[model samples]
Target: MKAPAISLLAGLLFGAGLAVSGMADPARVRAFLDLFGAWDPMLAFVMAGALMPMTIAWLVQQRMPRPIACEAFDLPGTGLLDAKLLLGAILFGIGWGIGGLCPGPALADLAIAPSEAGIFVVAMLAGMTAHRITRG
Candidate 1:
């Protein structure tokens, strides 16, 4: 169908998957990330499980007649790991560690824990705005 419809369905399905997998729960995510503190490995298994399907999906996409969106593939052709890229990754890791929530988890949190999600989203937006202002 239309791009908007496809995007909406994809987002709904992704949110549903996040909810079903307990990614929305910041506590659980934090516990998982705290390898030295709690040493939980279930999250690793969950991530591997998620990756397997995506790996098969990639294989299928390679054999498809054409892209689902009917557009030419415009995959990034960059392998350059510049300073800016490294710094951004460091910042992202710090934020994730501090909040125990990233884009996917933040979106999923809207259904079960709106207050925390709202805070995370607002902060994320503010950071983006601040970066734009500072960069310009």
Candidate 2:
């Protein structure tokens, strides 16, 4: 199939899987993340289920023939857990904890309330654009 068709199919599958797995539910995620409160571990199990296939695929990729470009995998060069990385992670965690909705969940929430999700998504895209511009 063509690249656009393949990409669209992959996105559809991913969205459907997220919907089926309840990852789109902020309340469910909030409950799962509330370890100190009435802690629910179901999301961990769900994440494990989701990751297993991806993990297997990644392992398989390690043994595959290199692409025609004739270069080794261009993985991230920096392995250091630097201060910037740590700070970014902390900010992300805080946002998730406060909102009970990460990007995917927020996007999925669009199905129920388009205006809110549309605003959030637009703001997110704007932030990304600004970051790229500033960094570049």
- In terms of lDDT, the best-performing candidate is 1
lDDT (C-alpha) at residue 18 in model 2: 73
Scored against the true structure, residue 40 in model 1 reaches a CA lDDT of: 66
Predictions in order: lDDT: 0.83, 0.75
Local accuracy of candidate 1 as per-residue lDDT tens digits, 15-133? 99888887777777888889789856767788889998999988998888777775765567778998888999999988887898888889778778899899999999999899999
Residue runs of model 1 more than 4 Å from their true location after superposition: none
**TM-score per candidate, chains pooled:** 0.88, 0.79
RMSD of each: 1.8, 3.1
Cα error, residue 62 of model 1, in Å, equals: 1.9
Best-matching candidate per TM-score: 1
Report the Cα lDDT for residue 1, model 1: 66
For candidate 1, which ten residues in a row score worst on lDDT?
Answer: 67-76
Candidate 1: which pairs clash?
none
